[model samples]
Target: MVLSSHARVITPVFSAVGGSGRSTVAGLLATGLAAMVPSVVLDLAPRLASPWPEWSSAPGAGLASIPPHMPLSRRQVHAAAGTNPAPAGAGWQVLTDHREWSAPPLAPVDAPAAWHQLAAVGGWQGVVADTAYPMAHDIVAARTAGRTGWTAAWCALPCSVPVVCTAATASGMQALQTALTAAAAEGLPVQRMVLALVSTGDGRLPAPVRAGETMLRPRVAAVVHVPYDPQIRAFGLRDATRLGARSLQASDLLVQAVLASAHASWGDPLPAAATPAALPPAHPSALPVPEKVSIP
Candidate 1:
């Protein structure tokens, strides 16, 4: 069978508490993966009051705007996924910021209908649901429901689906564990859980985090560590479109590792070239370094 035939969708539910870098990571992951196979990166972040027409720093021009209760269609979601430059008159591009909305409940029923719409896209090989810390509970619940729905829709192979959680700091990891524990207590499938350690320029995990993992690691599937790069900070800008090629390359490496472990295809070629200009010099103190941690 072709790789797409055996394609397994991966849903990455990111923690908002990590800062703007999480969204950048999610976007880079999704866009990069989509270049190889059909994928979607759902920005569950909140919309700002006044959106930037494009990525700019003009004064008084506020953040982007999002609808309060709009049921998104598949096409709308796809449009959001694709590159759309900001109109000169519009001011700021519609950036994906999930924190703009008031925190919603963790129940599946409370989730935006847009999720279901995106799930229906063609090929729909993977989805990355990037969320903020305040909305982590709700995002996890919604992702669980999505996985369950996919299993139900495609009964032939159930274990093929997976959910990855990305956290900015060790505290964010704790919040994820609490949310997952609650999900397990509620009878949700916890076996598919993967803890993605998102180091936000902090190369090492906090001592308290290491201690908590000693107790929680056994319950998770795998722990993947991704270091933060200074280039990721540019995502906070108003007109941020393209990400650093090195960052994209790093994400591709993660995708390959995930696919290999899942027995998915690793030979698939990397996506097209869309490298941005050279990044501004980062402070010497900001570069990231890799760390080793025991996976339970």
Candidate 2:
């Protein structure tokens, strides 16, 4: 479907490499966005690496089950994500890998179409996707090779914001710096990307991190520093509602930055009440036309 003001906002959390706290940032963003708008989390990561299955009650329901229609309504999405009766919450729904890790029906192969369909889902404002591993390198490689995996660059439409995650240590900072430079060189919308600086060790900011933040600020739309949370260290993100005050506040700040960035990138437009043009008459044997656009 054509994008409009009523479409959901898509936020894909990514990282240059592993050990970057990608999943943690994704959970925080989804839960934080849920505080205001009913949101959904799409765990586009591989089945073996996904962290959401233990938390989700539903089984045999995941990426493959998602409807590929042009647009999805809120109720339709919830039904897809839930059982006969949808989960009770104004919070969020999680869609992750539910099949065997090394089985057929690979998800990442068709990631972009899933993303586009979900973004067109009505009745929500956000979708925080935990992208696959080595997001920075893999996406560039896919695009460079003429394959159409879910590259954050192409998906950074007016309603979408791609976020890159990194740790706060010296080496971590350097890795992220290198990644941004390389991705920017490849035309991956680095200027509009969101940088998430996560701190796993508690204390005053490290010198390298401070310097890195200063150096990296201009290249991205917004930079968010997520402080270390004790609960996450003790347990996991299984209970986000129990996060410390500071961590919770950081999540909210991240949501605000995403919304603000989207607004700045795409000027506010009044929500349309109906389709702007008349649709062609439908026929039983008619085939659906492929949606395509030359972004450049």
Candidate 3:
């Protein structure tokens, strides 16, 4: 389904580790979304290339160049093409910095203004920003998933979703918990978090996360299991048509989870009636904190 006329969704793929497959998850979600809604995938990571050909940067055009309040109609895009054909065929556009930059790239903190401008563009219904590791400093990626402060708290844009990717390992979960703890300390507004467990075999989630049992801060919404697929590792791209049967199935489930989180963040009624007792406490005071705790 398409987003509401005025709705602007910014789904950031977050992870504690470098190879948690956040980009792959972001690409698959973008591709699936493109099938239903006109979308754009903004690769904020300072990488040289992307696996999907759909992931491209417009020549000499970046987020900073878009003027405020300007209409971004197809005609306007064509006029700015400058010998390059308008980016068509894909349901989304991948916005990136020009290959050669005189200065350092912009950080995610410098994005709220640009995001406001980009959302005003015509026809685009949603945006998926494939971010780098939350702890990365030299990149222009969203550090805290689901936190508006990561982008300076947009004025017009209210609905933002974070899909947190973590591998099935002790360190992965610990890293995620640490990130959540930091977000809480900063008073970041994180309504919900989509925890995507990427691992081998069936990719079952840990008991603590599945039961919503945590001393963490951000609210966990869903636990998605994306089984490790060699095909995806080899290609490093997201295309359901090109993936194996198992990978395709997992990818579909991940897409559904991402959209569901987005809808919930947008204030839509949840599909399933959730009992408060079934979920972790949403209030900070309810969280368990050790008495005179010490970290060794």
Native-referenced Cα lDDT, model 3: 0.54
Pairwise TM-score winner, candidates 2 and 3? 2
The TM-scores of all predictions, comma-separated, are 0.54, 0.77, 0.63
The Cα local distance difference test for each model comes to 0.45, 0.68, 0.54
Top model by TM-score, which number? 2
Q: Relative to the unseen true structure, what is the Cα RMSD of model 2?
A: 8.4
Residue runs of model 1 more than 4 Å from their true location after superposition: 1-12, 16-21, 49-81, 84-114, 132-170, 213-215, 236-246, 257-296
Off by over 4 Å in 3: 1-6, 47-91, 97-109, 133-156, 200-218, 238-240, 269-296
Give the per-residue lDDT digits (tens) of candidate 3, residues 191-289.
Answer: 466667677445566676544435442476666666777766775553344556666566556656666766866555323221112223354444578
lDDT of 2 by residue, 183-290 (tens): 776677776678999997889889999998998898789999999988877766656667788887888888878877776676554233222232245633346777
lDDT of 3 at 15: 75
Per-residue lDDT tens digits of candidate 1, residues 67-150? 234433334444443332212222111224333246442222224234433344322565555544333455455567765332
